[model samples]
Target: MSQADKLRQLLAQDKLHVMPCCFDALSAKLIEQAGFDLTFMSGFATSASRIGAPDLGLMSYGEVLDQARNIVEGTSIPLIADGDTGYGNAMNVKRTVAGFAKAGAACVMIEDQLAPKRCGHTPGKAVVSRDEAFDRIRAAVDAREEGADILIMARTDARHDHGLGEAIERAARFKELGADILFVEAPKTREEMIQICRELPGPKMANIVEGGETPELSHQELHNIGYAIAAYPLTLLAAAMKAMCDALAALKDDEPRTHLLSNFGELREKIGFETYYAASERYSTSRRY
Candidate 1:
């Protein structure tokens, strides 16, 4: 079966899937090596990794697609890409879904935030009209009908601008509109999390942003609350950033903590050096140019 089909089957089973966000191919491979069945291609991590910018809708669809392609190539695990606001309107949503599916995404998440969307945990966020949000999801569902098995995860950031009730209502509507999964982003309390799962129908996903507004729950807790998937979108990025900063600071202090970093051979091995070497040996006889 295809990776998308595999992901669908996995979601169908009675268990919670924890997907850590990966910004690039190496991280994706590491996630697979860590024995995860799936990984999320986060826009926040991608924007930060690619251009050192925040996730304020700075990265374009093409850039995210490139990153998704690289991650798909690097790992066999299913990837769910973050397609922020579908990169435009309903037509854009359709195109975004098709493009991500073509680029090997097992699923794509489209949010309801307005243009130049901010992070879900950030303030000053605004969502489009309810009709517009429905249209975007409908477009994505239609796109999926055109021979792409990619799942559509409809996300609502209405909880910040609107209230929890509104967020729950929007999630219900999104589920009715054919979203394979519902993500009500940034629920503040544990009660709200339970309420969301109890109220919303079908498969549900939860976002666990460290130090964010949402409460960080364990996988079992999330499963008990009826969440099929829980995504830690910035955990890897945050860890990587802190490690690099500390490494730089140590280098400036003349401490040069080389042991803290991966060796060159190990890095090469992580990036599939052995696979390339085997391919070269199988296809060629000599190394002379």
Candidate 2:
């Protein structure tokens, strides 16, 4: 089966897809090795990792695609890309969606926030007009061929700008416009998270964080409230950042490589030399004379 079909089937079984947001090839490999069912190629993470900038819709289409392609090649898991604001109007969204779908994304989500938009959790967010955003979704849904399983996810950053009720209405309308998934982003409290969940059940979701603007809830807590999926956008990136910072700090005091062997095996094993050599040896042994 195609990757899209596999993802759809997994979601059909009401399985809670836990997609860790990955920024680069190494992180993607680490996640795949750790046995995640899916991946989220986060625009925020990509922009931050690649350019050291926040996710303010600053990167061009090519920049985003380059980073996404690297992650896609690094793993076989189904990925859902964050196609922020469709990069422009309906025509732009069409191209963006097709590009991401062709790049091995099972789904691509575009939000309603205005161009040069801040992150959902960030303050002073603005959204496009309801009619305009709806048309964007319609255009994207129309662009993809039928029965492709290239899911068109519609996200709204209006929860913080508008109110929960307005967010719910926009979500319902997006659903009416054939959006496969609805993301109501940046709920600040547990009560807000529960309220968002109670409002939109089944194939609708809320972005969860570890210590972000939203309440830090466990996967089970989110699933219990009828949330379809919980997109953890920064846990891995943040952890990696912390670990690297600490390692650098250790280097200032003494030889950082001195303890590298203590934590992981020697450099060669850590870099998978043994795995490659063993595979080579096995192939050599099994070769025909």
Candidate 3:
């Protein structure tokens, strides 16, 4: 099955999918090895990992597509990529969706945020007018109809600037425009989250950023609240960063930091070294003509 078909089947099942977002090829592989059915290439985490910068629209469309391609190549599971602000106007939205689809993304998220959009939970975030927002989704749907073979996830961040009602209304129209998924970013309370699900129809995604605006509900809780997917955008990144910092601190203290290390054999296996050597052994005496 196609990645998009796999994702659709997963969503069709009556359960909430727990998606741990990825920032790079290695991270994507780790998540897949850990048995996640799907993953998202978080712009915030990707920006930090790739460029050592914040996700305030600093990474261009080409850079984001390259990252998406790397992550998609590293795993067999479906990937949903963040296509921030579509990187330009309505036509640009189509191009971004097509690029992500060609890169093997199961879905590409296009938000209604203004040009040079910032992180959803960050300050200074603003969305464009209603017409422009709808136009973006329309273009994305058009791209999909034109053989992109990817899902369109329409996101709205107007809750922070306007209100929950505005965000819901925008997402509703996006759904009408043929968005396969709807993301109302940064809903601050459980009540608000519940209300969003109650109001919107079809598959919906909840972005759970650690220490951010949304409530950190359990998978069951989110499922009960009617979310199709619960995405933890920064959990892996945060955990990895903390471990590296601690390992470095122990190194400074002249300690081996064995507790901070994975078993060498397991690491080698996870990195495919063992598999590579085994495959090489079969060709050890072979000479190509």
Question: lDDT tens digits, residues 1-289, model 1?
Answer: 7778988998998899998999999888999988998999888888989988999999888998999999998899999998999988899999999999999999999999999999888878999999999999999999999877799999999999789999999989988888999999999999999999999998999999999999999899999999999999999999999999999999999996987899999888888877778677755664323
Alpha-carbon local distance difference test for all models: 0.91, 0.78, 0.94
Higher-lDDT candidate among 1 and 3? Answer: 3
Question: Between prediction 2 and prediction 3, which has the larger TM-score?
Answer: 3
**lDDT at residue 43 of model 3 (Cα atoms):** 90
Q: Indicate the worst ten consecutive residues by lDDT in candidate 3.
A: 280-289
RMSD of each: 1.6, 3.2, 2.0
Please give the ranking of all candidate structures by lDDT, highest first, separated by commas: 3, 1, 2
- lDDT by residue (8-104, candidate 3, tens digit) is 9998998999999999999999999999899999999999999999999899899999999999988999999999889999999999999999999
User: Candidate 3, clashing residue pairs?
Assistant: none
The regions of model 1 sitting more than 4 angstroms off are: 286-289
Candidate 1 accuracy as TM-score: 0.96
Best by TM-score: 3
| Best lDDT among the predictions, by candidate number | 3
